[model samples]
Target: MSAVLISVAELQELLDTAGSRVRLLDVRWLLGDPDGPQHYLDGHIPGAVFVDLETELADPPSAAKGRHPLPDLAHLQKCARSWGVSDGDTVVAYDANGGMAAARAWWLLRWGGVADVRILDGGLPAWEKAGGKIVSGEEPDPEPGTVVLTPGHMPTVDADGAGGWQGLLLDARAGERYRGEVEPIDPRAGHIPGAVSAPTAENLTDTGHFKPIEELRARFAGLGSGPVAVYCGSGVTAAHQIAALATVGIDATLYPGSWSQWSNDPKRPAATGTEPA
Candidate 1:
C-alpha cells in the first residue's frame, strides 16, 4: 500500500477496528462550490469533520500570490489542531471529486510534516459503495491537539524558477487548457513555457481511484532525468499530481502559485499550442 493513499476497503477497516485512533476529514469541495459546508452537512462519513478548501486549506487569493497561496504555518497548525489532528495520528482526507480536492489536505498536511497523512482513494462515493454508513450535521468540536508543524517537507517552484526550471516542468491541467483551446478561469489562457502536458486526470481510472502503481509509474516514466515539478489552474489539482507521483516513488515539487499566479504577471511568458515550448 502506498503511503500517500488508502482504498475504501482499507479506510472502512480502519474505522471498524475498535480503539483505533484514526482522524477522518471530509474535504468535499469543488472549484466553484462555495457551499461545501451545505453538502457536508447533508451527509458525510461518520465522525468525519469538514474542512473548507477556500479558507482553511489556503490563504486568501491575491493578484501577486495566486488564488490559493499556502496558508501561514501557525494558522495551518491551528486549523489542524481544530480538526483534532495530533502528532503520530493517521489522518485520512476525502472528497466527492475523486481525490482531487482531498489531495490538497493530504499535501498540506505532509508539507506541514505530518508523517501519516493519506487520501481516501475514490473518496466519499467509494465509502458509500463499500456500505460505510454516513452521518449528517456538524460533528462535535474535538479536544485541541498539541501537534506542532514545520514546512518544506515537500519541494516547490516559483514563477521564476518554473520559467527556468532545470528539471521537467509539468502542466497538470487538461490537454485543451494546455493547448490554450479554452480557459474557464484565471487572468489568461495557456501554460508556462517548456512545460510538458501531463494532465492530472489521467492519473485516475474510470472508477475514480488512482491507476495501479505500475500503470502510474509507466505513465510518468522517462519524463524527467532530474527533479520534476507540477502546476495547474490554481495549484489544487497539482497536488493530486504530486500524490500520484508519490505512489510511484518519484518525488516532485509543486508550483503552488501555478498558472493563476504566472499568468497575472505581464512579463512572465505564456505559451500556447503545447509541444513543450
Candidate 2:
C-alpha cells in the first residue's frame, strides 16, 4: 500500500535532518532465532526501537491460523503506539537477514493504514557498510504515538481464496520445501495444489539487497497473467515476496494463513515435485 523500500543513504539523510520524525523499527528475527531482542540490544541503529515479530507483530501460533498469523488490529495499533509512531511519521524497518524479517514490519504498517513506511534496503549490513553508527542498550521511551490504524489497506487471500486463485499463487518458501523435499517446521511436506515455487531468496542479490527492478520484472514475467498472491512457511517471508514485487510495480495479495495453516488441515490437498499440481 506504500513504497516498499528505502536506501540506507536516504534513511540517513532523514535521520540527520532535525525533526525528521522518523520512527525506526528494528524487526530482528530469523525463522528459528530467539535472540532477536538480544541482538538488538547488542547493537542497533541509534534510536531505533526493537519490535518482536513473534509477539508484537503477530498473534499466537496456532495450527489453524499459522505460526505468524497477523495480529489483532487493536493490538497492532497499541504496538505501533508503543513504538512511538505518530500519525504521518516516516517509519523505516530493518534487520540483519536481508529485509526478510524487516519486510514484515514494512507490510504490517502499510496494512495498518500508515502511508509512509519502508524497509531499509539491504538492511543492517547496508547501513554498516556505509559507516552508519550503532549503539547498544535500549533507547529512551519515545513520546507515545497518537496514530490510529485500520485494516485491509493491503489485499489478502484466505485458504479458500488461495485454492481458487485465478492467477499466480506463488509459494515463497525455499525450492526444496516447495518440492516436498524438505519442510522444516510445518506439519506436511509439499505445497498447496496449483502453486508455483518462487523462493524469496531469489528476490535478493548476494549482498542481501533487492535485485534491480528490471531483474525482478524479468524474474516474475510470464508466470501468470491475472492477479498475484504469495505465501511462505508461515506468512513472514511472503511479505518479502510482496516487497520484491512492489519494486517492479506489481501488487500482490498475501495469504496470511500461508502454508503453515494450510498444511495443518487434513482436507487441503498438497502437491509435490517440480511442477504445479
Best by lDDT: 2
Every candidate's lDDT: 0.90, 0.92
Write candidate 1's Cα lDDT for 93-147 as tens digits: 9999879999999999999999999999999888888888988998888777779
In candidate 1, which residue ranges exceed 4 Å CA deviation? 18-20, 222-224
Clashing pairs in 2: none
Estimate the TM-score of every prediction: 0.97, 0.98
Candidate 2, 159-198: lDDT as tens digits: 9999999999999999999999988899999999999899
The superposed Cα distance between candidate 2 and the true structure at residue 260, in angstroms, equals: 0.4
Candidate 2 versus truth, CA RMSD in Å, comes to: 1.4
Ten contiguous residues minimizing lDDT sum, candidate 2: 1-10
Clashes of each: 0, 0
